[model samples]
Target chain A: MNTDTSRREEHWQRTRKLMFITLTIWFIFSFVVHWFAAPLNAMAPDFFGWPFGFYMAAQGSEIIFVVTLFWFVRAQHAIDKDCGFTEED
Target chain B: MAIIKGDFIDNLPKVYLMYTGGFLGFVLLMAIFEQMGMGSDTIGILFVAFTIAIYAGIGWLSRTMAVDAYYVAGRQVPAVFNGMATAADWMSGASFVAMAGGIYFGGHGYLAFVVGWTGGYILVASLMAPYLRKFGCYTVPDFIGTRYGGNLPRFLGVVILAVASFTYVTAQINATGTIASRALQIPFEVGVWFGLSGILLCSMLGGMRAVTWTQVAQYIVLIIAYLVPVIWMSNKQGFGMIPQLVYGDAVQRITELELLHGMGTLDPVAGAKAGLKALSVPFAAAGDSWQFVTLVFCMMTGTASLPHILMRYFTTPSVKAARQSVAWSLLFIFFLYFTAPALATFTKLQILDPNLATGIIGKSIADVQALDWIQKWSNVGFLQIIDANADGILQLNEFFMRGDIVVLATPEIAGLPYVISGLVAAGGMAAAMSTADGLLLAIANALSHDLYYKIIDPKADTKHRLLVARGLLLVIGAGAAIVASMKLTSILGAVAWAFDFAASGLFVPIVLGIWWKRANRQGAIAAMIGGFGVGTWYLYMIKWGGMDIWFGINDLRFAIIGMPVSLFLMVVVSLMTEEPDAETQAMVDEIRIPTGETVLKAAH
Candidate 1:
């Protein structure tokens, strides 16, 4: 019983850690990209007609969001598998 | 089993190809008519008829008899398709027509809409969606009522859901009315009634089942309608097909023009119409960071908490599918959102290009007034050409137009044929109607399921509940139609406030219920009252009390204050009170696990 409890605790801790890391990336991509967009646009040349900061804020972050979403899904699924918490079909 | 799943996946592509092929055939017919020199009015009517026929046909075919099917499509939707439906349900009129214009006028500062909305899905995917899916509930308030185990919490959930969704649906209906009036050539007041009838026809036919399939169909129309004119404008303007990457040059050019005119670069028109010159300053203006950040936070959190959006996840087959559907939703939504800023940039260039502007360096106001597109749109009151300096030639600052015009005028601005303009209008209508259907279902179901069945009459069977739900849909739809006809606020402004209220009122309890074991019924109730009450009172103060900023926060960004207060109160109250019953704690634990079994529904 004690071992079972410890296993559940360990599983939750790993889940929490994964969530923390992914959320940090989510923050940087979503918030940080917009926060520093002006400076970035100022220093950068027009790439494909967009200023660097403007491109990132308007376009690049959405791409990052897609990538981040898949990454989080894959990582969480992997964690669930390793922890034997995968939902039975 | 695997073979069956693989076969189903293979069928999806064929289905999409057939649908697209059919839609494109109609587009070809419209093009032929344009080639025949058909008038714009005829094309607009044709476009409206064609789009509505497709949606109404889909809604009719998907109509259902069983309550489960009506409420959630029998929970059989695959992840990618559910994602498409959710995207359609999410990209309302504001996103389809106004977002690009907002970006065009507000510049970098307006990226808050982009970041806030897409980022909210991250919260949904990680924190809310999968757990709620695991709980095996029908509505957002269903989860709240079930998780907290009470009538009052459930009732309060119904109130919050109704308030937020009603505000949101009214905005959608307003968008619909505007698009209908413009396309079909009717008064906005009568157009709202027309729009609401269409909304009721789609939703009342089959409930969520019809709504889901209709949204999927709407998604295709809206995406095609959005891309065609944009891609054409980009190619014509020498940006090639990849407008998303090449629009930066347009921005640089606009900035240069601003410099020549001695107007500051970045967001020259932000809040220009609102008479808030303080907010109309340049992008990343001083002391505006907090307000900007709070705006994004409010939108992001609000997106997660919205009942209509979260209800989309419940239609998916499993918790895993729920998470994957969110990713697909972002992908589907990204196509339009990513292009919106580019469209904004391209439209500005079209408006400002010397060849197009034509009233050269020393031209007369008469010359500027003779510009055909200007006369047409300005007559619609969407554009204002004030000769502020009494100079005959047009100055960049003299062109003050509502942001919505950027989208509505795009096809005309690009000199595209009238058929393309018709297509864009149809797409905007699809966006508004699809979202309105989902929102109306959410509001009606909350009253019928959460309030009526669960609290008022637990013994009510599925047939009785369905009847009540459909009746409530009519009442709420009519109520929203009345409000929409009033035109109290612009679509985006009303939408932003709806997001603020949902985020502030519901975000704390929803998040805490999943993560914190100590959260009790008392905590949930207190949090809702404290957060929603404070946030709403602040909005009232700002709007009617003639107050300007509350401790450096504006009314639009009140979620920043209300959310934290709600969280604090929930924690403090929960700590002071008795913990939840053991069964409730176990239910929370069960929810955290991703087991595929149907978890027992919360007992009354």
Candidate 2:
């Protein structure tokens, strides 16, 4: 019984690690991308005719958000399987 | 259970075909009306009637007497459809009509609204949805009641939920009035009643069951309504059909115009209230960057904590389905959001281009009044062509357009015919009504399920509970309608305040409740009171008391202060007191695992 409890605790720790990494990426895409947009725009006024920072803020960050979420979902599922927390069919 | 669940999925194609056929037939009929030269007012009325009829028909078909069906659609909804409905429910009038308009007026700073709102779903899918599903509750307050092992926490949850949800619902009702008046060519006061009846008809029919199916249909209407004008405008402007990829040229041109005019700089004679005439600011500028980050924090956290949105997850079939549903919702929502900036860019091009504006740069307002679209919209007070300098010709600074007008006026701005304008108005109505129905149900459920059934009549049967839920829905719906009809000018500002309140008051407690075993009833109550109190007080002081900033944070973004304070109180209070008992700890363990089934834990 004690071993079972310890195993569960270990599984939760792995899950938390995944959460930490994903949240860091989420923060960077949401805040840092927008924060540096001006410098990028000034560096290149037109990236394929889009003001560089305007393109990143308006469209680029949103595209990255969709990708980030899907990656998190896939990674979390793998962790769940390894931890033996996958639901039985 | 498996067979029953499969039945809805099996019939989905048939349902899709029937709805599509009916909608196409209505469009054909409208096209014929256009050939007959029907007046714009008549055409607008016909558009409203046709769309409302389809929603009303769906409401009647899905009506149910069972409590399970009324509250959570019997927990049988397939994920993809629920995702579509959630998208429609989540994208309110602000997203549909005002976001592009806000971006149009506020420039890059406004993109924070879009990024903040969509990014919040990351938190939702990761932390809240699956566990809430595993808890297998009917409403958020229901979870609070059982998790805390008492009435006080549950009652307090209801109070906070009602305050947040009611503020949101009133704003949605105001949006409904604006769309109805624009579509039917009536006064906004009369339009409020027309909009209220449509909302009540669908929601009162079958509670969540009616609302869920109706929202699916509303989603189709709104997305089509949103895309058509943008596609047309893109092709007309030579961006081709893929406006999302090629709108950069338009932004470049708009930038050139802004630099030439120095428009965003305030006009001293008109005072600072005249507002931005150009977009010259850089990113990472200290004041604006902090404002942007705080607003995003508030919006994202607020999105995860909103009771109306979270309730949609409870209707899905399993914990995996709940997780899948959030991803699908983002996909559906991105279709509109990605296109919004494009819409703003193209519309700005039309406003700036000499050929589209027609009259010479120095021509009189009278000369520009000859332009049909300008003449029509100005009559409705949506677009104002002010010649502030009393010059006969129109200057870039002379035109002042509101944010709400940007989406609704896009078709007209692009020189589309009357029928397309009517369709855009219908889409706006769909966005507003779908959100209003979800909010009304969230409030009604808090009162009926949490307050009445749990506290007032614990032994009440399922049938009795359903009756009380429907009754409360009508009462709350009427009250929101009355507030909306007052034609308050600050409706949008009020909606922003509600988001700050929800983020501050609900986000910390709800997240810690699920993740931390040490989170006790006293901690949650203290966090709710402390967080909500600080948030509301800050809002009142700055908005009414006339302060510019509080402790260096703007009043509009007070959640930055309120949230951390609440988190501190929750952690400190929980450590000072006893942890949850053994059974409660067991309940949290049960929620943490992703079991295939969503069986309810027995009550405390």
Q: Kindly list the interface RMSD, in angstroms, of each predicted candidate in the order they appear.
A: 2.7, 3.0
Question: lDDT tens string, model 2, A1-89?
Answer: 78766767777778778777877877897788777766777887878888677777787877877787777777777776776778653
User: Mind giving the per-residue lDDT tens digits that candidate 1 earns over B1-604?
Assistant: 2321335445765776788888889888989988999888999989987888878877776666687878887777889999999999999999998898888778777877887888889888888898888888888888888888889888888898888899999999999999999999999998899888888888897888889878888999999999989889889888899887667777878776545644553233332345222113232222245555677789999999999999999888788888899999999999999888888777777765665542222346687677777798768777666565665666655566777767878888778888899999999999999999999999999999898998889899877888999999999999999999999888888888889889888898899899998899999999999998888888888888887867777767888878888898999999999999999997887787776465554222
**A84, model 1: CA deviation in Å?**
2.4
On DockQ, the candidate that comes out on top is 1
Q: Kindly give the stretch of ten consecutive residues in candidate 2 chain B with the minimal lDDT sum.
A: B276-285
Model 1 TM-score, 2 decimals: 0.94
Which residue segments of model 1 deviate by more than 4 Å?
A: A1-7, A45-49, B1-12, B265-287, B355-363, B601-604
The CAPRI classification for model 1 reads as medium
Q: List the pairs of residues colliding in candidate 2.
A: B263-B277, B263-B278, B264-B277, B264-B278, B362-B393, B363-B393, B364-B392
- For B493-545, candidate 2 gives per-residue lDDT tens digits of 65776778888888887888888999998898888889988888887778788
What would the TM-score be for candidate 2 when compared with the true structure?
0.94
